[model samples]
Target: MKSQIRVVWALMWSRAAVLRSDPERGEITTTVIVTALMAIAAIAIIGIIVAKLTQKANSIDLG
Candidate 1:
């Protein structure tokens, strides 16, 4: 059982070191792009809502 465990662990590490780079690069690129896009979208949405609210506030006659 111990030898079997050692063999499996060695195989796992070898596989890990081999297919590590491309997947890591792809994951990082995807995360950065999604994060940037989400921030831009959030800012634009908030700006639009704020502008509409400002206009409405200015046109009110609350006397």
Candidate 2:
């Protein structure tokens, strides 16, 4: 997980550097693709967390 986070950070930093160095390079397509991928990953992570929480809540022995 830590490595995955680091990799993402690195990719974002590199993308930002490219845009910073060449503002008129027209990297919009790349930017859009990366943003969509990140959004999807965030949704998936949230879903997993919600599912785990729901499962644990259901297993509680509260009377």
Candidate 3:
């Protein structure tokens, strides 16, 4: 049983190492960064639109 456990542990460790060295990892990081930037840009655009609309609304003479 102990030998079986050791073999399983070794296999898991090797798999982890293989995953850690994968070249595709950078693609995921790049994708996440791009998505975050796009989200931030969208929020900024919405804020600008809201501000402009609010300014326009306040300028209407209600008197």
Candidate 4:
């Protein structure tokens, strides 16, 4: 079991070394501003939906 674990670890390290050595960033990366805007929009939509649902449920007066 220990030898199997060591072999897996060595393979992972080797792959990482290759990826690090040949670093390449193509033109498909979104900027920080776009990412932040999308996140905020998603959060706002979720918040509004949850708030409206809660308000509706509260108005029902379920006892």
Across 1-61, the per-residue lDDT of candidate 2 in tens digits comes to 9999999999999999987899667678889999999999999999999999999999999
Clashes counted in candidate 1 amount to 0
> Runs in model 1 with CA error above 4 Å?
1-22
Instruction: Please report, as a residue range, the 10-residue window in candidate 4 with the lowest summed lDDT.
Output: 23-32
lDDT of 4 by residue, 35-60 (tens): 88999999999999999999998899
- Pitting candidate 2 against candidate 4, the one with the higher TM-score is 2
What's the CA error at residue 4 for candidate 2, in Å? 58
In candidate 4 the C-alpha lDDT for residue 57 amounts to: 87
* Candidate 3 lDDT tens digits, 1-63: 999999999999999999999988679889999999999999999999999999999999999
Residue-level lDDT of model 1, residues 31-61, one tens digit each, is: 9999999999999999999999999999999
Candidate 3: list runs displaced more than 4 Å: none
Query: What lDDT would each prediction earn against the true structure?
Result: 0.92, 0.95, 0.97, 0.86
In the predicted model 2, the residue pairs found to clash are: none
Candidate whose TM-score is highest: 3
TM-score of each: 0.60, 0.59, 0.74, 0.48
Model 4 shows how many backbone clashes? 0
State which candidate has the highest lDDT.
Answer: 3
